[model samples]
Target: METVSLTINGKKIVTEKGKRVLWAALENGIFIPHLCAIEENPLPFGSCRLCFVEIEGKKEPVASCTEEVTDGMIVDTRTESVLRLVRMAFKLIMSRHPIICRECPANKKCALQDISREMGFKLKPKRLPQILPDLPVDDSHSLFTYNPNLCVLCGLCVYICNEIVKEAILDFNFRGFITKVGTFKNRPLAESKCNSCLKCVEACPVGALSRK
Candidate 1:
């Protein structure tokens, strides 16, 4: 409940103490590009790297979605180093993302697609591995399908299902690079207590989870 004042993008703003930099920036009307931090969800899941910002007194750049705002803090929402890092992060995220923009239903409406174009990533990176793994597509559920390959591991779906819906149906199955979101016992979502809620599908920024 405590309040603090900070300078973000040269604008003075007051926010509650311990508020994440992302929430403070948004509340103050400073739009920093972000994908994984949804307002209704508490889990930050700062994997996107799109909300990186330069904060004074910090050695390296920190993720706005995860960094807590401090009093009298000087935060640069857009800087040369921050832009470079963001652009690179965009490229990396796009590398594994499916290139179904022209043929897929989401297409222009896709958040990832829109963000990539906005960031001026015209061509995909060639240095990164071209061979992407194929994850199972779960179509048994009447409402949605689970395609782990397209997932950016943003955890938005997991958060929505567990935190918002209170279903606790989906979760990460493994660890490290092999990790993928799945239901308990790796059963189909239809077999779980999912309640056929489409909140998870709606929360997914990418086509990793979609309504069928």
Candidate 2:
């Protein structure tokens, strides 16, 4: 395979050409804070925006998951500006996302929680007022529950359903602040076209979709 040379955190490395920056760093044992990234998924989902990296000559840090590695690129995985943006983004996400970390089953397993801890954050709800209202949970499926309150809208479930599973049973509804992943026509999972694959539940980084 073709290769490209790049520098990440001042360490020079060579990776496959056209590979995503996040994967390149990770392939070489460099951890760039990220969520919504699964190695099996071929496409990049830049929903989390937590994998921001400062590329030299760029005015702002770009989402590493979507940005491809180019030859001679200089990347900084950790910078004050990158950390600040990540924290701010997490704060906003956590404000609307319910924080029942104490009793939550995914407390230790959640990607958001992991990133928060890595950033030296407490994972507490910030003072930012929520723009979205709480929604009812969907436990119609026999195998799992769908809790919109805990959803970070990372679209991993939807991606797995549509692309990986090829069922297209789960999808987004509404728009803007009201957007959410749901069954077609607001139907329940059991009643929808879901094939009981349980891929969506496994793809969820948080407890938004959990086994029942």
Clash tally for model 2: 0
Compute the lDDT of residue 82 as modeled in candidate 2: 92
Model 2 lDDT vs. the true structure? Answer: 0.84
lDDT of 2 by residue, 1-212 (tens): 99999999999999899789999998888877776777667676777778899999999999999888999999998899998888887877877776788777577899878877777865774677656557888889898998887888888888889888898888998887767899889888779978888988888889889997
Worst 10 residues of 2 by lDDT: 124-133
Q: What is the lDDT of residue 190 in candidate 2?
A: 78
Per residue, candidate 1 scores C-alpha lDDT tens digits across 34-107 of 88888665568777899999999888888898888888999997788888898888778767666766755466
The worst-scoring run of ten residues by lDDT in candidate 1 lies at 117-126
- Which of the numbered candidates is closest to the native, going by highest TM-score? 2
Looking at model 1, residue 119 earns an lDDT score of 56
RMSD of each: 2.6, 1.9
Query: How does each model score on TM-score?
Result: 0.83, 0.91
Over the full model, what C-alpha lDDT does candidate 1 score relative to the true structure?
0.80
Task: Give each model's whole-structure lDDT.
Answer: 0.80, 0.84
TM-score, candidate 2, is 0.91
Show the colliding residue pairs in model 1: none
